[model samples]
Target: MYTRAEVYSPLQNTAIWLAAWLYSVESTDETVAALTDLGGRHSYGGQGLAALLLDARASADLSSHEPVVRLILWGPGQAAGLHAGSAAAEALGPAGAIVIKAAGGFSHVLVPRYWDDGVEWRWFEEKKRLPEPSWLSPGEADSLLSRATEQAAVLIEAAGGTRSDLPNPRLTVGTLADFYDTPGLPRGVTPRAAKVLARADRVAAIVETVTDRLGDHSYDPQLFALWRHIRTARMAGVADAVQDYRRASIS
Candidate 1:
């Protein structure tokens, strides 16, 4: 039997992929179809990806020029590529962001708001000059991947390896397996970038799976440290993947 990673798309950050895809290509029927396929994975408030794209285009005049798209992945202690105290940065405190830079220096940042019902999109217009995102170089990306690999190993060892049965599991391995087994990547994504993204997705899945198993016991000092390590590693992998994807798209 094929491993879950082999069968799955390994694209965990959908917003990043979507933004990069939009930046790379024109809004054709194919683009819409691809968006629909990816957006269908999430539960949205309105008409989903189509509506979001339509609103963005209408409000920002995005069609006039191909906008620059940058993905921002933020957490409690980490806010890479975001200016502190800015509306866009504050709005995207924990959840990630997709920043679209249109003509005439118009910038629109889209942040996802998670509610009990579903996920919704929130747009914040950046009037002030936003700081340029600090992108990772190819070597930096490789270093990050190496760190992620080590962290993944540590997490797996600490979690006593993967468990098939856990009491009241929040996210089952099966569910994640199925969830990731979908279409991933946009056109023009380089093979290297795709590989990096796949590794990132695998590390992220490991983090989630192990965290679910720990449950309430995740607060244990040693376990918590291990969790933090894996989480940080996963974030690094994701950030590198995003940088690689952007580079591939632009180059």
Candidate 2:
């Protein structure tokens, strides 16, 4: 198992969590096909989700070294959003990254810095069908992020570590774009629509589509453009391109 020091050191100043999810226990590959077969569009299968998690799992810098915190709740109301089992938690225990399960109801939680050894697990009732986790609205999401940032700052202070001591996790454009386009991923943009937006000409259309969907909320077209560029750069693995986009966002 990973020590608190190992996990906390890498996570110091970062507010965002480096997270991965297993949407369901179902497998198209035959194993547990009947017992836990959660169905979905074949294109958006476990392969992509698993690949992302596997990459992070293999690299400490991508996984545990990134900024993250874990919170747990025991007994009742385990129907919150996405979840995984003990086996998954055990697999990640050595890295000090926690698997948050069940509590999809009581607000988004920022896992505390100082916690005891060993990973904790929570399970849901088998009979009840729960709604898949969806992105929170802009206001709700912002509130959650604010609370999390404050909590992270306080944890850093208690550890006698200055904010400057910790570095922001260097996130890929794809990941950052996902964060930027909140309340509309894994659902809002279908795999098909995502492919359509891959073309240069479709950029404006996608932007317009998202803006329209957002209704009367204040929206920034430039930020959306920047996000699109960043996604392109990260997908292409061009660090300089990503940096250029980031610089452009502020300028």
Candidate 3:
């Protein structure tokens, strides 16, 4: 049986809650769009999972862990997979950190304490440190996801969407056409993004593969990595191509 802290730990804060809300967005393009909206509104300290994953150049003290968290929520499609010595694992450590995945590609990560010594804790203590979550539990993840879903639902409805227009069960697709149509994605790339995009053909293939996965009712971690590359390259052509593919999927 999982403990309460294990569940709520993933909630992190309002920012993570917001990210969870966005995660409930089923379409990758729409997910990216919602993330772009969030990045525009928040800074590093408060950046949500989407902002951390999509913006290549954006840096945060805990940004290194984003990939791991991404995998936890998404999949093991990361090229290198999770590295025991990497920043994400180290930050998460063995200190009761856990990742939970559900049907429909919905997932989350939780840690009992942020001050764990696994991720160079000595340095965090000397400079800046994030706080530990005090309100998490084994079964609370469902409620967190629900709350996030409700909030996201309200936002989408306000923008001319209906519950039936979205996906069913675990998550739904929201209206993010306005967010995507907006100009100027933030610039920045992470080391992982550079490696993934190094082979443009591979990146394109992964996009196609993940699209298929979604059609079959699955999620892929590589999809998340691809979005990171798109944000880094600022390749509107690629974004357009993805949007085109999405449109076709529904048509």
What is the alpha-carbon lDDT of model 2 when measured against the actual structure? 0.26
Q: Rate residue 67 of model 1 by lDDT.
A: 28
Cand. 1 TM to true fold? 0.63
Per-model TM values vs. the true structure: 0.63, 0.21, 0.21
Give a tens-digit lDDT track for model 2, residues 102-193. 23222222222222332122222222322333322333333433343344333323433222432222122233334323322121222332
- List runs of model 1 lying over 4 Å from the truth: 1-30, 33-48, 55-67, 115-118, 161-181, 214-251
Model 3 lDDT tens row, 1-251: 12111111111222222233333323445444544443333233354444434432122222122221221211123221233454444555322333322233323333323332211111111121222222222223233333333443333334332234333312222112222223322222223322222232233333332233223213333233343332222222222222232333345
Say which candidate scores most in lDDT: 1
lDDT-sorted candidate list, best first: 1, 3, 2
Off-target runs (Cα >4 Å) in candidate 2 are 1-129, 132-135, 161-251
Q: Which of 1 and 3 is ahead in TM-score?
A: 1
Per-candidate local distance difference test = 0.51, 0.26, 0.29
lDDT (10s digit) by residue, model 1, range 1-251:
11222212222355445544445543446555664565443333445666776655555433433324555554334444666777767666344666666666777888776554445677788766567644454345545655765765575555653444664233454455345535655555545555555554555455456555444345234333333333333334344454555555546
After superposition, the stretches of candidate 3 with alpha carbons farther than 4 Å from their true spots are 11-81, 93-251
